[model samples]
Target: MSHFIHQHRFPVLLFAIVVVVLAMTYIQPSGKAEAFHTKDELDYFALRSNMDLPIGGNGLFKASGECAGCHGFDEIGFASVDANGNDVNVVDDWRATMMANSARDPFWRAKVSHEIMVNPMHKAAIEDKCTSCHAPQGHYASKFMGESHYSISDMLLDPVAMDGVGCAACHQQSQDSIGLLFSGKLKYTTDVLYGPYDAPPPIFGSPMMAWVGFDAQYGPHVETGDFCAGCHTLVTETIDLNGVLTGNHFVEQATYHEWVNSIYVDDQSCQSCHLPRIEDDVVLSTGYSFLEGRSPYGLHYMVGGNTFILKLLKDNISELMLTANETHFDTVIARTRDLLQNHTLDMELTAEGIEADTARYRVRLFNKAGHKFPSGYPARLAFIEFVVTDAVGDTLFASGLLDEDYNIIDRDEDYEPHYDVINHPSKVQIYEMVMGDVNGDPTTVLLRAAFPIKDNRLTPVGFSTSHFAYDTTLIAGLALTDENFNHIDGVEGSGTDDVHYHIPLNGYDGPLNVSAKVYYQAVPRKWLDEMFDFESDEIDLFRDMFEGADHTPELINEASIVDFVTSVRQPRPTERLKAFPSPTSDGFITIEVPESDRMQVTMFDVSGRMLFNESMIVNRRFPFVVPDKAGVYLIRIESQRAVYTTRVVRQ
Candidate 1:
């Protein structure tokens, strides 16, 4: 099972095996500098000019029995809304956003408690990089972290989570139900959650507040796409620099399983294409507007990679417009480049029947749909785009894009234009845990708090503090089995817990173009180049709002001229293809395509992992099967589509 995957840790898998099949027949043109991010004129909001450096607090919330008599409360009864009973007010969708500033920001509670006390179940075991936006569904189910029901006073009674983040996280719900969960049980078994307002008559709020049902079972898991892989998939685990679990592997976030085994989960779902309700006319938010209020139900907004922060958090050019087939940012890279051009694939190898480099076939590509087919925000990167031809089309055996300095692999910044990072290098640890408004000494929350201060979050003022002062270190009262956590067993058991992706599928000979692409950009920058900053909107809002600091100087965004790819054939590959009773103890196998050509029958193994793929059109003689797992496999066949592969051993 030769396997390879990359997310930029340096030269890895040669930039997707050499610049993606020469970027599939070229199509350049995308050039419109100075300020392109228009969902209808977005500017976002700038200041800088006399820009006084610090302000930080007041983004607001504190109240509840005002968050602990004033700035310290954390619960709203686990703050919820789901099971399709929907009026989802996890405190008005976390007011300013960042899930209500997730506990007054201090750089996201000291970079998620310094990546959970430096790892091993302290937290961060994989799930969409920082939990598909911080605890998206709060780990499958347990009614918000369970111990009966989590703490830190609902981060100050959900001051929208001090605007750091909180809106029942990704639209609330509970019952997930896959395996374990006895003792009392009812925590998850399947409920409905699409939050805020997942359309269906009843305009906004009040189909009993618009939706949020429980007790389990709800509409195709809220419309499928696998319920946004339980928080866009950013899991965690692996340890040992003394943390233990030497089995090995770290860095977690599957981007929703790389678009669920690729070829766009048959037909999209993260909201049928990013929050699309079809619209009888669009316009709901009726909490009152016409003048006095507004907000009947449409602003889950959720679209990430932060188009420079929605150009500036939405004024409303129809909410940053676009959807005529989603204009970039995350449709998992235009639905994985239209599922690699409508399932464009081909492969072959033949023995007893003929055609053979000694006959050897093996091709397997299944990125499913997000969950890792390039799910979300974690410095995006996925691999595969092999091409091989012969019988006439010429070419034979190819790899990915490029980079071992051969360059050519910069899909903006390696897909999803993100490049500019620091990621809490290490040293911060004010743990005991007490996100906002704490008075102190209830034994600990990292010892009563107060370091580098400045609060209120969710975009606007931002500020993040703390690397040590954890009030003498109560470390959330210790115990994770007394701090020695571990759990590693995946790739085959297909269970390391969550946030997954495997990546390994190579087998080709003719008319082959097995594909997978999800390159998105707008972040990577040690400095700045977005093709020479186009000039100014304060250098494109300091490179789209603080991406690589020093107030923002610019220069980053390459690709001036790159070409040298050829191999386009209507007919030219066919060394000889066949697949008969050879070794079909009955499971099925018979092929002969000609009526003008167009075939495709695949099966794989030898560690490439694609069980089957079909499309024979019906020329008269076609029978296929053998997929359960008997023994040596690998078979492919394609037509004018010119491709053929071989290898069929079973006994």
Candidate 2:
């Protein structure tokens, strides 16, 4: 016996060490990180554990009906009252949001049909990608299990799939399950329900809890933008018009990453802006625990800048009537309008009377959003509408005007590459993302987009020009010429855009009222009707959505001023030597001479180091590669035509 014990000493010691480690892990005191850490919580060993959950099974999530019985105010047998004498419940507010009825959104349905009809081979990928967010609950449960139907009609036919993003869909997003920030790699489970706050007190005789059998757990992912990115930031395969693969993965949306790269990520979160917390003390339901306590229950309205869609849904009672209650539609609209009007952009207007019977008005638009203005879906567009009129309200010059049918009237008729310099009444400064096909021409078909022909959307604060190489390469000519297209020239790192409008006074000398408004449109009329076919059911259905609907652009932010022009200011001559690609890569620069045939080009480093001092005849565009490392450089051009000084950055 003594000999046996001595031989087994090492084995016994190993067992004791294993036991100690297990005990330490289980008995560790809960800290703030464990209680509310928003980043990924999965360790190396548990990283792939989420895949083991029943994401492909319908039984993995309790229907919203089951949870709403206790969490909702309008559910039968539930009696939760708020401070304002109204029935208060999570479902009551959330159900009416865009998140609740995402699948039922007419635009989504019509778009899915149109895409599939356009490219039959892309049917499965498009359906899977869209359903991953629209009807996440049903899509995950069925698509992952090979039980999904690619057809939009079939998916809409399923009641379980029509619920869109329900309570179970978000609560089941465990830190261990969510893989990556986007592409809908979210995993779900019914056994555990996760939330931002801790300690969801259980009701004494709550049958709903007993039926769900969910262990309430605190998970910070519920409040983090990474979780939202699981659905928001999207990428899809690009296909061309000839049904050929474009070999480029088009960035469909980058709202989440755009916000992540901005300065707002450090201080504010997606939930902070969208789902604002409301302090309240109310009975959650009958037989509730902790009946009266100050709890920061976030408002679940989930209001966004989609005023047109929300109004359309509200007016159409037959479409998802129960999801977004008609009674709460007005409140949601008001909230959405307020968010767009006051929160998105800050505008400042300054004007001076110019010579040649013209008024020069400078409009600066500062992007206040965490991401680019009109960040989501590429279809969204936002532009400045600058108008000047006389005291008698007689229109003098107006840009960015839309016809009665809501079609942009001031845009180039031939759809010339893009517009940066809008000097004439027929020209307008439009801020939008225009996708291009493999041929480098603008195309509206999302799947056929190989690159962005034009993306002049105002960049967020702290925009890194390096991140937009594709845009710089393709649209650099116009981008470099227009300050509004590239704010980096004047306010690098600061997401503010300035536009100087030179409107011809045309002999009008009286005080002119200068007005500027920023209008946001979800879908441009040209894009919507470009590929539209009245004979096709899908196209007809899409067109029907706008019938009798308020499809007009929503005014995001506006500024008006009375420019008392008593005198005229002379117009400055245009800069002679033009520079293409101001932010030079590989230390290369191009200088074009439109008027003079001879000029002197001088270059200086940031430390005032003289790099290049040479005289050359520039009859045409001159290209030079400076032999300097990556840094800021100053270039001066002196010619018989004009003298110009410009700052250039080398990378």
Candidate 3:
């Protein structure tokens, strides 16, 4: 019987494949038939014809809402306090995160639309590649089918596709499913829900488990970086405007691979930071059989450094109402800001002897992320803004200042690229990745990106220049190697970059206040504005969706070099100053200094977003202005010799 089955195995498999394809074709929503004119469609057909794996077989992958109904709060809600003391609900927190709204992010929509508009013939592939990660359940459940979800029709046809990285997506990941380079290569089974625990208590009779009907099993892969690599690392195949292959593949975002060679791999996984285990054991839902015995579960609050977009969504909740409620939005926003405050970057400033009235200052930036600083998404960029001021708060020198429209003042008029050292107002040290087309010309459109024009993103610890040597050969026109990006020349072993700035003091005194800020922008003005310039309906739609968003740069961290010596004429005073309305929501602040008249007051929000800095003449009472946001803020009042730091809360 076995021999007979083996002899006819190929034929049976082929028959099954044909049946599945036919069934899928028939089940496809009416008026949503795919057109075959594009190169992507042609490639799809060829691949389908020659594919060894089965296609179009519907799997048991479920939607995020389905899982939430069981694992999260229902009519009877549950809440927990976050680091910021905000009451956080599990469902609300997860829903507000980027993982849940991956399909609904406006920047992503704009980028994908721009890619499709520029490379019309490859739209099918672009959609598939992007949706593979964003809408994994929709794509994988359809058996590696093409174009899981792209438009309103997709959302209407398959709601599961719009769930973003849903519950089933992560739980279903199998060892054999992930590929070497992470771009949504995951195999799954409906009957099994893999987890980090070696032996998850038998949950068969649990109410939630019974509803889901999946056996909980110990899957060690869940705890490794390899699991996150299944989607975090993205690779895109390049296609020229004329529909011809560029013979190049862009390693668009290699966060997973970057971690593999980093020092954190041995001791930490992505979960250690992003999904840190909470010390307290908590029940997800009451009236459940397995609720009481469960140990501390990893916090489902997958917060990341995406404050800009999260805030945008919160402001436009009427239009983009993905979160559970207003409280949920506020919780996620606070959590996002808090996560951004984690060890992302460190800045140190040093000044040498003044020469020719020019102060030579050295600023060193250290990357604390496991991957490249500002990694993931080519549109993201990070830079340092150094400023110097005299005792009277007169700006002596400044670098990396943004114009009114939020464009970084670059030496190049168009701000095409940024440099490292900044000795002049025109220079900005932007750590970013710039892509080039097949002609070696810079382009932001994803499909035409054949090579990197320049990528000076800070490397992680233990980064090897040799591991990425193959990228040089893979690049069509460039003969460059990985040395340009990695700083592993047997000298600088890890992800640290040093930049020197020589500011012309121009007769400025010795007590010049020197301060530097490290800022990060997920989507820069150039990329965002260029996307809107395209004359495509899809692009316009996304542009409209992105209106009123905070596209300006965000302050990641800031540091100031304390002045050691003060001028003898204006001696420093040691007197503590107090600010009134400590927890005021009225946006009114007052600082009182009895001894000092000329004092520098600089205020920064908890996330290091600078409000303003000014030298004020303080008498008995001096009124100050602060941002209208509710949060804890740090107020620094500096005199010639002593500095006073105080915290104020805006209720």
Candidate 4:
């Protein structure tokens, strides 16, 4: 019997395997039975199911609507209202901001689609990386559950993703390597929601956990600039035009690094200006009547200098599925306008009396923000519109004038260079960062960008070229050579720029009226040209929106001197002291002190380090051998009447 069984065992096993396979095919779950089924396919189904769940039902991220229940405006006045009864609700303020509508930003969507069209092979990588910040909740949630490549399709379908930078996205952020880790490298805790306030007593916290499935915990990092750095400091890989990796990276936006290099780093966080603290103690949660009114309440208006996109979002609210309405958007836009006009910059326009039939005026700009003025996206720019008119309102000279389509009329063929002096109407001073491709030509494609061709954006106070973060927030092109761009007496960190406008009087100098204005454009015409050239659904949609919308740039600041006449002034000996071969290639600079009785001259480097000091009576030109270093130097001359300082550049 044993010998018979051994011989028949092979046949029995084969028959059993066939029976089991047939049974499994007929009775098993249809998903498991499919031959081509992959883990991603299964996970996608699960992801869809989780996303479809009502609000807080999802195990990880909850829809922002869930938070709106407590944080939104309340008619009963129990929460979110200031002492003056102004409704400063968190959800209402945030909903209208670019941060809230980041996912719905038509320009960003169009740009992303444009990049994908240019580099089809990198579609997956681009979508995944972009959604990491824009649609973080959905992207991170899917990634958390082992799903790879969160695409735009996934973002559109997921309710959490469409919420943009929602409550959970920021509150659930884990305080781990925040400032150090950038470019959407964010970490999150599953069920812990962070806030600037300390953890509520168990009585309040328990309800929060019960209501939203998240424990409200104290997280000081939530109030830090480093927390925002996770997204603000973006460094992207450089790719060739043919979709090949260039083995280099570009600092796409360095808002965080720019702040770190400025004077405000020690005193202010990103929240200080954007969020705006309210001194009145105010209730944080609705229905918690016994809860003490919290002090230092920050309004959740996370606005930047992107009023153009905000207006676009407002106009197309229904199309974008925005939670905020038209009125909310208008309120936010007004706030943004105020921020750009009052907080961003300060300008002083002075008439440097007419000289040689050429009326000279100096426009000095001081950046007051924590970072560079017009920082963040490289496309943003602020240009000075200087105009001089005759007594009867005839145009004498005008630079930085825009065409009907909002494109700079006098913009250079490639890009405008930073100018210390503008003698002609064609030369305009535009504060912006221009990206260049491998060929050193300007390119709007982020992936193709190899380096910055021109980045003369106004730096913040205390911004130094020698700072550790200066490499990322560099002053490129002609601005690097302009001594007055961010320097005073060759000392860096002035956060100011002086543009001397030498407008020709043209024999008509009767009461010249001068007006100097600084205008900012987030979605500049030049930036739109490249993106519009691409044929895609996103691009088409954005083009339609842009064409229909008003293309007026926001007036950041303006100054005017009405009815001014050139007058002769008494000249001093110090004013006559001339420094020849200003940007000297040789080691020596000739100082011609015309009427010098006894004068002390001192020389300093860009860092304010003194190099030489000499006191001598010189009536004629003398060659003073300067340090042979190739950089900006400050030369100070002291006489009896005045002390004068001028910059000398060594080539």
Candidate 3: global Cα-lDDT?
0.64
Using TM-score as the measure, the top candidate is 4
lDDT of 2 by residue, 1-651 (tens): 000001224435965996686556654355322322224543422331211111112445555655654565532333455557565567656665778768788777777777777888878777877788888776766644566443455455455566778888888887864526566667766477776665545423335355566776678778777778787777778888887786778777777777776767777888887888767665554545545443676667677788887888887756433454465666778888898888898876655346567677777778888788877777788877888889899888888888888877767752433454446777777777778788887776788877776776777787666654223222322554665554534655567767778878777766677788999988777777555753366567657767768887999877776654542232334364566676777777787666555455667678544466455666666777765588877776655445567777777
User: Which prediction has the highest lDDT against the true structure?
Assistant: 4
TM-score of each: 0.23, 0.73, 0.72, 0.79
Tens digit of lDDT per residue, candidate 3, span 254-324?
77877776778788888887877866545445445444434555777787677777776666655643534
Q: For residues 351-382, what per-residue lDDT tens digits would candidate 1 score against the true structure?
A: 11112222222222222222322223332223
Candidate 2 segments whose C-alpha is farther than 4 A from its true place = 1-57, 74-88, 144-154, 177-179, 200-208, 281-286, 289-294, 319-322, 413-421, 467-477, 480-489, 534-538, 567-651
- The candidate with the higher lDDT, 1 or 3, is 3
Poorest stretch of ten by lDDT in candidate 1: 455-464
How much does candidate 3 score in TM-score?
A: 0.72
lDDT by residue for model 4 over 19-95, one digit each (tens)?
68756754555555553446875564343221121244234688776776677767578898999988888987887
Clash pairs of candidate 4? none
Candidate 2 clash pair list: 96-324, 354-569, 355-569
lDDT over C-alpha atoms for residue 584 of model 3: 79
User: Better model by TM-score, 1 or 2?
Assistant: 2
Rank the candidate models, highest lDDT first.
Answer: 4, 2, 3, 1
Clashes of each: 150, 3, 0, 0
